[model samples]
Target: MPSPDPKIISGNANQPLAQAISRRMSMHRGVKVGLVDARVEVFNDQEIFVEVFENVRGEDMFIVQSTSNPANDNLMELLIISDALRRSSASRITAVIPYFGYARQDRRTKARTPISAKLVANLIANSGIERVLTMDLHAAQIQGFFDIPVDNLYASPIFALDLMHHFQGQMDDVMIVSPDVGGVARARELAQRIKAPLSIVDKRREKAGEVAEMTVIGDVTGKKCIIVDDICDTAGTLCKAAEVLIDAGASEVHAYITHGVLSGPAVDRITKSKLKSLVITDTIEPTQAVKDCANIRIVPTAPMFTQAILNIWNGTSVSSLFDTQTLEPIYEPLYPGLAIDA
Candidate 1:
């Protein structure tokens, strides 16, 4: 006999992504998801009002919402939805956030600064979320912030497949470039899979979202560079790195970032930069400005997340889902002894 289907529900954060996930789940036997009419309004005083329209009694409910634009409002909606599921006698609740906000504030850089990522984690746990499913968090350590089980998925496998399919013969001339030292692990993973040389752009930021200077840390000269990173909010560092790479004799430059949080003048900057293309995942909804940018291209992650959710539901291992070219792990055991097949 097959296992019972988990009830997947969604809020107003990113309905399209939720629906895509639902459609993928429905393709399998005995699996289905319903959307709760979680509409919200702001009072004249700017207070949030949320309503959950579906019954979740005794069901394994999964609430899908990405705290993207208007982060506070979306976050409140997720909390309210989770609370409703809990009150309705739902067996379990999983918060599926494609793009988790406040992740950039994981640690305190200066004194007295709040660790907002931990605060957000606490909020989700207090809101009755039993587990969390998100992608490419800005800081991997933010997973420790949450008390509940958290599954941090990677976009490298998806990106690697796309690169191989499109640029198979060009791998020899291609170089995987990390925009900074912090992203070396992510870039190295992609580099090993594609069998390309690895490079790094040593960037100095005088202030937030501002790149003061850049130094190429590897032999990028005469190479077609692909800069990889987790997030691209303002695109300042990426643009500066592309310029520096070109100045260092790079033949071409491209970027493949996981989350495209193209805020402020990011689209304008990327459109004018030396980057040949800027590929990103659909973790966050893209704006008209981002869609209109000629250099931007989106590679869908629906298939990848779809497989992961199915594996989790069917008691299968998810490690093989990410194992490309048999490379070693870069993360330091976020959940030790917790087998994916369990």
Candidate 2:
């Protein structure tokens, strides 16, 4: 028998995305899935407050919170809400974090440094969330940090479909480029999906928040170059990479990023850069600046969330929603014990 329909609870980080996902869930199941009302606030003294208004006892709960900008407050909101659901006796609680914050800090590069991503994972797990459903984790290995099931969904499938529809005849003229060596696999998968040639950007980061140089590994001359990456913060590396591509005689440069962490001059940089357009998913709430940037476009991720949540609720396979070669779900467990059938 199918499990009970899950209740959709949202956070303040990305209300638009939450509403879209909630609406789509009802549209798909042909039933209005009850949404539990949640209130999150901060006191003037800097304490966080979260409350779930509706009764969730004995219910399957799904909390939608993107730990995006204002990362601390939003992260607290998600953790506190999960703790509340656990205290309230919710049968199963799954955290739906569209864009996980602190994910980039997954490893330790120097001595006396902390693996902050693992700490965040431990915090989430200790808060009592049985499962996590997130999109395009910054580091795939971070899933091993948690003891729960994580669904790490990819944006490549949707991106490929959109690229095919928009650039049907000119697909041959386009070359998919990874912004760095770390993203080669991601870009290669997308390139294969769209039937385009692959290129890699060899970039060296001098220090935190600074990229020294970037060199293209493959030929981009006379081609329409499309740079792809998981996150775009400050737009520094990406814009510079586009300039390099243009200097290499590429016809045009475009970017398709999964998360748009457009912080600190990102909009200004993008507006003045050589990029023809920047396509990002609606995982992070777009500020007025992002919306006003004529060259930037946003794609909806609600449908993907809807399908994955539905499959989880129905106890069906979600493998088809992940990358074709990887066969990994949105929430992939890093540890062997985290392999939960749910």
Candidate 3:
């Protein structure tokens, strides 16, 4: 017997991204995923009304809604959509979020502060989402908050490919640098794949939107630097780290961040920073400010994501999807160096 066609529905948050994914799937036979027009309106007193205008009975449903900017509205839309699919008897519902907002509020900094990440997880679970398919979460541990299975996809493979393609044959001179110590693991993974040395920026965050100090922790002198991180919110840390790298005698500095949650004056800062270019995935739709920035470039991940969705539907191992020629290693350096000496 053939498997049932999975339905792909998207909310107002990111219809374009959903459309791209749907178009990619169309290339493969026996795949049928369509988007549902999710029109939302505000009644009196700021109440939200979401209507999913398609039948989904007995079908596997995937709702693509990134809880990005206008986070509450997008999040609410996802919840209501999931609830609608559940009431309509969908066999399963998966929330495909490319950029998960309120992820920074995963923990409480002060007394009485709410752990909104956990709350959001509970809300999605209670709203009848059977699984979650997200990429490069601001906090990886956010997966622990969800009782349902969560597939956290990495943008590293995509970024690595782009970097290799752009650099061509200069991978040996490039070094992957984590903007801060917290992101060493993420940076190390990219470094290992590119066969480049690893470096780290030891930064102290005095407060939100501010980097108190930045200290380079590896041999970056005369080497090109690539800073890797999950999200680039204000571009504060990235800008500061680039300055530190330049001061440390690094020839050039670049950045590859997953979610370009470029809020406030992030674009302006990047445009004026010492960093040559800032590469980001289209996890969140780039604001006009980001698009206008000459130093910013976006790499699409639709193909990667589309394949993963298909793999999940067909009971295939999505892990092997990362090991492909499109994602093949470009650099093989003679020396393997660590950012920090243990």
Candidate 4:
């Protein structure tokens, strides 16, 4: 018997991204394919239900869902979807989580705190998924929590390409700044790619959700600075860092963040900050407040994800997709006549 064609489905967490990925995949191989009809219902009792319209038996399945806002609901939806596919005898189930929620809770700050990230990993492992493909996890060590293979893609390459255009022919005036000590390596990678100096903000947080003070470790006088970080929740850190950079005589400040989990007051904070602009990837769908911010811009991850999925299906290295200076694909599509549309 012939093997079933690969199938891509999505949950309610992020429909726009799912549609984008689905559309590109359909164009690939010149074959007409769309999202698998899966409906998620929340009854009056707040119980969750999943319905898969198409047969997934013996098929390679990829479910694109992000556990973003309303984290619990989105997370539960993903687990239920995975369970349904497993019961249907899908040959393989890979969870494509663009913005992994609860990633920041990978470690415990106090004695009694739970390692929610590990718990989430355990839950997904038990959900019958064989592999995981995600981007810019808050903590790299979170990968170790899973028994299955995890492919973590980076948004640095995406930012590198955008930076080249944003500051064409002004490499001398550019610098990469990390908002906190922990993000130094991430900022340095972008700085090296752009051939600029690197700086860091030494911030001391008194407690969770409250940043006390920030000091710029490097001279920022008369240079355009770009702050790089993984997650932006309330925008407090970025806003304060931008202020400190400006106070240090920096000519201008901008930011590039991988996952824009803009929660309460984030839009307000960014709007009033001294930064010239802020750029974020569409790992999480932007809220209406975010859209209203004039200084904020969004970069699409559709192309990167499309190519990454192709790489995964072909058993090739997904990391190669972004490491190149040109941000071009290192491996060609393995399937016969399957063109890279995005």
Error of 2 at 267 (Å): 0.4
Q: What lDDT tens digits, residue by residue, belong to model 4 across residues 119-150?
A: 99999999999999999989899999999999
lDDT of predicted model 4? 0.86
Query: In candidate 3, how many Å is residue 242 off?
Result: 0.8
Residue-level lDDT tens digits of model 2 in 70-170:
99989998988888889988888899999999998899888999999999999999999999999999999999999999889999876765565556679
Query: Model 3 over residues 297-324: C-alpha lDDT tens digits?
Result: 9887677778778778887877765553
User: What is the model-wide C-alpha lDDT for candidate 3?
Assistant: 0.83
Q: For model 1, what is the alpha-carbon lDDT of residue 313?
A: 60
Candidate 3 colliding pairs, count = 0
Model 3 is weakest, by summed lDDT over 10 consecutive residues, at: 333-342
For all candidates in order, the CA lDDT equals 0.80, 0.85, 0.83, 0.86
- Segments of candidate 2 deviating more than 4 angstroms: 1-4, 323-342
For each of the candidates, the C-alpha root-mean-square deviation to the true structure, in angstroms, is: 6.2, 6.6, 5.2, 4.4
Per-prediction TM-score: 0.90, 0.92, 0.91, 0.93
* C-alpha lDDT of residue 135 in model 2: 91
